[model samples]
Target: LNSPESIAVVVAKPIYWLSVALKPIVSFLGISTEFLLKLLGVTVKEEAPVTESEINKMLTEGVAMGAYEEEEPILVENIFHLADMNAGDIMTPRTQLKWIDLNGTEDEIMEVLKNANHYRIPVGTDSLDELKGLVTVS
Candidate 1:
């Protein structure tokens, strides 16, 4: 109280006295420091950061505990694979692409549609390389 150096005394004295006063009760009840602080109306701020492994562990445990069905992992894997997939990866090769001649008659077009089993067909002039545009049959 006499100098700035008494700040520690100012702070520590109350804590020391409070601890001394609470020791008998805490020891009698065998309460933890955190629980004691909570019982004293003091909120303890804490953080538990979750990692990838922890999430995986929790998911695996959930699967084992029947919280999730067996197909749940498949969905997670498909989600992961989605990021790696590109447009070309899932498209059919050029060799297997179905096309329709621009000069084809209505019967020819219907035949192509019947054989190709597709609602839309790519229109071309003489070959697939001379691509004109898409033809959608509604």
Candidate 2:
């Protein structure tokens, strides 16, 4: 029990247990620092953050002035909206998927990759019903 591994575990034990113990209390609070300070009878003022439209307007001006060489302005806009999106919300239909078989040989895989445009391809064992997983080609 006095070994290096055991010593490391003992040192980390408090951190793990403390998180487990505090998780519930932390979840219950679910308040800002200002809220906690107010509970303790301290004065705190919180400011509202800048709106998304304001930031987008600034970026639009930057693009209009030719500050960015490429189409970074459009990219920033897409990223801003992408933050509020989920993969499932934008997933292609199963009928329109470009997939490959799991049991395909190297030659078959090479052929598929040669003609394919994407890096990640859905893999299936038998049919699309038995889809194993996705394969990412480097």
Candidate 3:
């Protein structure tokens, strides 16, 4: 009977060889598993498993460095799973967004700008659900 280490090596060798052989085919098909894994915060480096804090730090650093903008947006056809994203991920969420009311007077708009400390505010009728336009403080 083969030793456990010998059997494991035999099993791993074929998988490694298969991956190398399939690399070109995968590239041709635009299937970048490595890229996806990287996006999911997986490190190929020979280090211990990443902690939540480490992942958060990496994500913040990536965002600050504009790493995502550097890469081409992933196409739908090339994706295996539905991408996990939120409205806040792509744009400002309603809660964080500052806006002015359509019925608000110029004085009222000025008051909002003074209080809110924002450069731009959306003008809406009744509520933000009915966006009229944008007001810039300049």
Candidate 4:
């Protein structure tokens, strides 16, 4: 009775009998054995983690299959693309940038900064080409 096979038989016999006994009730209720096990807080299987490439492929396929909204896949794809982007790729062009003039009055600088709605603004001498330093607007 202490042997491994004996122990297995001892442990498996009750489970086999239980399944046999529950089969008819399960059939009557039209529910799967796995579903019943889940209701009993039993996990049947565990899913492995997906890689980034797999996730990107799944998102592409899901969008093509119309399983996801256009915006949803686009957002996920953008996140994937973000890893490949450098600062130059995401930075604002110098022509469109806002800066605080170093020679401007404090009130004028504050007004310009307020209108720009920027947290860290670049401070320059006369133009952007003449770099002074960075100013943190609180």
TM-score ranking, high to low? 2, 4, 1, 3
Those runs of model 3 whose alpha carbons end farther than 4 Å from true positions after fitting are 1-92
Per-residue lDDT for 23-138 in model 1, tens only? Answer: 99988775677678888999767788976567667778899999998888767767767868997887777788888887878887777777874567888987898999887766
TM-score, one value per model: 0.36, 0.41, 0.32, 0.38
lDDT-best of 1 and 4: 4
Candidate 4 runs further than 4 Å off: 1-79, 84-89
Q: Can you write out model 4's per-residue Cα lDDT over 12-52, one digit (the tens) per residue?
A: 98999999999999897766766788899987678889988
Model 1 segments beyond 4 Å from truth? Answer: 1-79, 84-89
Clashing pairs in 3: none
Off by over 4 Å in 2: 1-13, 19-43, 50-79, 84-90, 102-115, 132-138
Worst 10 residues of 3 by lDDT: 72-81
Task: Candidate 1: give the clashing pairs.
Answer: none
Q: List pairs with backbone clashes in candidate 2.
A: none
User: Which candidate, 2 or 3, has the higher TM-score?
Assistant: 2
Span of 10 residues, lowest total lDDT, candidate 1: 50-59
